[model samples]
Target: MTAISTALPAMSRRDEIWHGLRDTFPMMVGALPFGVIFGTLATAQGLSPLQVMSMSLFVFSGSAQFIAVGLVTSSALWVIWAATFIINLRHLLYAANLVNHVRHLPQYWRFPLAAMLTDETFAVMELRYRQRGSEGYAHWYYLASCIGMWLNWNFWTLVGLVVGQSFPDLKSLGLEFAMVATFIGIVIPGLKTKPLWAAAITAGLVATLLHHLPYQSGLMLGALAGVGIGLVLDLRRKKLEASVYE
Candidate 1:
């Protein structure tokens, strides 16, 4: 085992903080336009500023917030809850990513990381840990990334609120594309893995085939199918590995 450093000298802390700040900038830039759009839309949909900011702060998930706004407009609490549950289901994936990297950390550390986790932070942490093999203050690095994201998310959300009042054409600003592109970029790379590829394709096909299902239930079904297929593939992989050793 690599020995832990006895003390994090001054230079190391500075470097970690620097790395954190540098990595955070791009995400902040990307969030600005999207935040503006969400803010404007919430206003258009008749949500009070208090409601918009409340959702932004407490829910802290854009997709879920968007879905919630739609349901609130329609006054369908049950559907809103159901859709929010489905859309935010990706949190499970984020948790899985955290498990891979920080599961070895103390329970106290791991639990907090899990609570603060977001898709971007999870992706960044996973990428860095995979590349660097989790040495040299990795926990701090992950914390830095989360701090950056949390700040960006809240900051741009506030910007959105202010801009939403001033600019009625926020949707026309086309900021939503950034989020679409980000998710696509993250997802496309996973296709390199056979099991993941199979799961993704199967899920997409199932979702499309069931698109006509009532009340968009197919989305939940697709997620379930994808997760099930992935788990089965993982079991087969483990069985094969055991056979080789036996």
Candidate 2:
């Protein structure tokens, strides 16, 4: 208890809020290029500025928005939905893990936090929860982090729209790779365990092999297969550990 107490910083609410934004700044930076790329692609896809801006404001999922941009004309509606849903399945795990920490909060607080929650927010918030054990004004930190990311994304999306409109071929500049780079940074660090390894590797292989499929169905299939395989392996591992303990 003493060690844990000493390890967790005792900071003011203002400090926590600042730390939330300050700590997440790198993640924000990583995502900036992605935001610009998305805005460029969406506008290039013939979506109006209002539509592009609304998507950023409301959807806010970089991965999903990118999928929508690529598939809006080529893929069916159901395919887009499935692709986004599969990509976002990780958020379910994120929410489940963080639920206990915020269970004491009112519905109003939990609702917005849930809505604004992203990979970056979850990464930082999980670390914060671990360090502080959910004490102090941690949710304020969460809120501020969300606010910072949300604003960053929307702002860049607008910039992309403006620049892409002027250039009209910004998407052809081989810039979409920024999303790939950002995602690699976000995902690679989390593949410490076996299940995560299986999921990522399997997803990549399957998505690659099935890339010829129409409507970007490969992504949905690969993601589903990877999640399913990872879950099975995780469950088996847990059962084996339990039996050993027993």
TM-score of each: 0.78, 0.78
- Please report, as a residue range, the 10-residue window in candidate 2 with the lowest summed lDDT: 1-10
| lDDT tens readout by residue for model 1, 67-87 | 776677675788888777777
List candidate 2 segments past 4 Å from native: 1-6, 187-246
Per-residue lDDT tens digits of candidate 2, residues 151-230? Answer: 99999999999988788776677766765776687788778799989998999999999998865678778887898989
CA-lDDT, candidates in order: 0.73, 0.87
Clashing pairs in 2: none
In candidate 1, how many Å is residue 224 off? 3.4
Candidate 1 at 36: error in angstroms?
1.5
The all-Cα superposition gives candidate 2 an RMSD in Å to the true structure of 3.5
